[model samples]
Target: MAELSPTAGESNYSQDIQVDEKLVPKKGLSLCSTRYGIALIIHVCNFIAAAQSTVINITMVAMVNTTDHQFQFNGSTEQLPGGPNNAPDSLPAEAPTYDWSPQIQGIIFASAAYGMTLTMALSGYLAGRVGTKRVVGVSLFASSLLIIFSPLAAELGLISLIATRMVQGLVQGSIFGGQNALWERWGPPHERSRLCTIALSGMLLGTFTITLVGGLISQTLGWPFAFYIFGGIGCVYCPFWFILIYDDPVSHPWINVTEKEYIISSLAQQIHNGLLSALPFIIAWVIGILGGYLADFLLTKNVRLVTVRKIATFLGNFPSSALLVALPYLPPSYITTMTFLTLSCGLSPLCQSGIYINALDLAPRYSSFLMGTTRGLANIAALLAPTVSGFLLNQDSEFGWRNVFLLLFAINLSGLIFYLICGDAVVQDWAKGRKLTRL
Candidate 1:
């Protein structure tokens, strides 16, 4: 098995040099430095992208008129249960609501995932070919623009809204692969868990914040504001991103040589829903950061890296799946439901340190491509999850929700078992051939 020297691809480095822990420059290495700054900004972009992806989950309640079905009572029309939560009296007289079926709502919800599935792999390829700067930057800006127009699209028609959301998904999907590509250049080996988790924890926080406030925004200012506020934030963020971010440390003028060397040398090693509706995610975010720290701690302690990854994967998947299986059967109480859900969501993030970062270890050179390909296929779940739930729920709400949970449990367990049996952290034979570079 051959491996590229850590410094082989870096500029002006013809010979290998030993780096002492004490000798490695430590100044300008904290969160204040350029690389960390990039991570933080990527965090913000993730926050925006994730918020846009899910805001409709909460806001749809206000967006749809569930009272389309009518009944006769003394020649007066009465509305029956078309969906949950929305009622004629609860919303403003002028407020718009679509006469969409639960199944239609499912399609709307899943549309973005569908779009994401289509583009994720291509986005990864483009990121590698053209650079993440253009791919991610243009995608973010386009997604934001789409988000701002989402309400208008809804007003135009259901098809318009779904099309808009799907387009948003297409563009935003690039972000996942693109960000990973960015990290391939910028992330250090030892700091892999912490940095990756920090960037990803934004998704949880974004979900938490949007789920917590999205409904409130819908009820008070109307659902459009939810779109406007979040979309606007993404638009506002683009200039700063373009100005501050570079695809790799070498190209970043602001980065000092010491940090650049540290990042490149380290590279050799490679590397949510709502309050009340949001509770689980906030817990997950906290646990995710903690899990990152724990993973890094174990790595530093010389734990077999693959072993650490597996343990985290098991902790994340097994318990969470078990809880999902048990949740529906539990006594129907708010506290009981929340407890299982909170625990499930919280534990699931441990995988951030496990299966999530395994690609970087397995193939630093192809990490972005692997991420895009795997995630694109895995998005089949996202594409089907809501639609399946909707169909099942339509059959029977309680039983349907139960079935949904059970199905998830089965799927997650299967994936956990497969990965436990096969996942590896060591670099692969083919991937080891190339030194780290743009592609």
Candidate 2:
């Protein structure tokens, strides 16, 4: 294999590998240097993360049910579960009572979001300091460990569960951040959009699979088993990732000189420098916040509006309360939830790719910085979503959920305005005006 050249104007210590022109055409390079393997590994990692998220959702319902059926009405010595502090009195007064209320559930769900918010903001800095591969591997391992322990925390008390979930969220945020940086480093320019879409789509597939599998496990083996199974799956991926992935294109033995050149040249033309590069970050932030909120809103309300009435009618056909009892037993609810979740997963990535592509189009060199900044900002919206949703649900008004959706829709509309104003495809002339400056 030929030795790789250092990036122009950057020091040797920077270890930046520039792609040459010969890599563009498949015929010019050997199979070993191609990007297919790298893309596949990244996608696999994404799938695992996506599946993990869905499994948590499924497990939450099962755990709450288990707590309700086994502890509360049994008159056990356990204290009633609280949100952040004291337990609420609204818990159902019956046998097999649960300690925590819906409000508490919302808090647990939001814990991850809070952790994710902080980590995502710092991800770019971390990746720059350490390297994408290390960050990715560490985050994946940490997330898997936290997920495995989450059920044990649940058994301890509500506070434990929240704490564990918050840790998982922090790891998850790093995963997202690291993965984004990895793509920028490894993916080819021509195929970035397609690869991004594929990675994201796999995430949707994983989300759907998790719901299906978690629901089945809950119905048959029990709810705690769902966490065990998903956590195990996450652990399995770690070894595979370590063996298969590399941080940069030239580092891979299989990638050929021709393909590497093609990738480098394709990316070189797209980078922009200076404050002008920040424009895409702002645009993506506005878009992602709206997109994230809309996804949660639709999952919470719109699906029910579209399908719940029919489901209720079908259940009503059965004996009294029989449908209510049977609903959890059936897989349709999980399937419906997964379907909606998948749509959100699918849409958000495509939207994000479009934004990123525009960034590259306008400023190729600054793409990484712009992407990092925008994603960090977008994550702030993610942090607010679950907490805001919890607050609305706590209101106990008839239109609580409705109000949440309304707010989400308004946010999405605001994003649309930004998209129209700032999301132009044409590259701006910011970098051309400045003298050549190397980082």
Model 2 residue 217 lDDT score: 76
Error of 2 at 278 (Å): 10
Residue lDDT tens for model 2, 112-194: 76566456646645665576678878888888877777777877777888888888888887777656666656655435544
lDDT for model 1, please: 0.68
| Clashes per model (N, Cα, C within 3 A) | 3, 22
Off by over 4 Å in 1: 1-24, 69-77, 80-87, 268-439
Give the TM-score of each candidate.
0.56, 0.53
Candidate whose TM-score is highest: 1
Cα error, candidate 1, residue 299 (Å): 48
Question: lDDT (CA) for every model shown?
Answer: 0.68, 0.52
Give the lowest summed-lDDT range of ten residues in model 1. Answer: 1-10
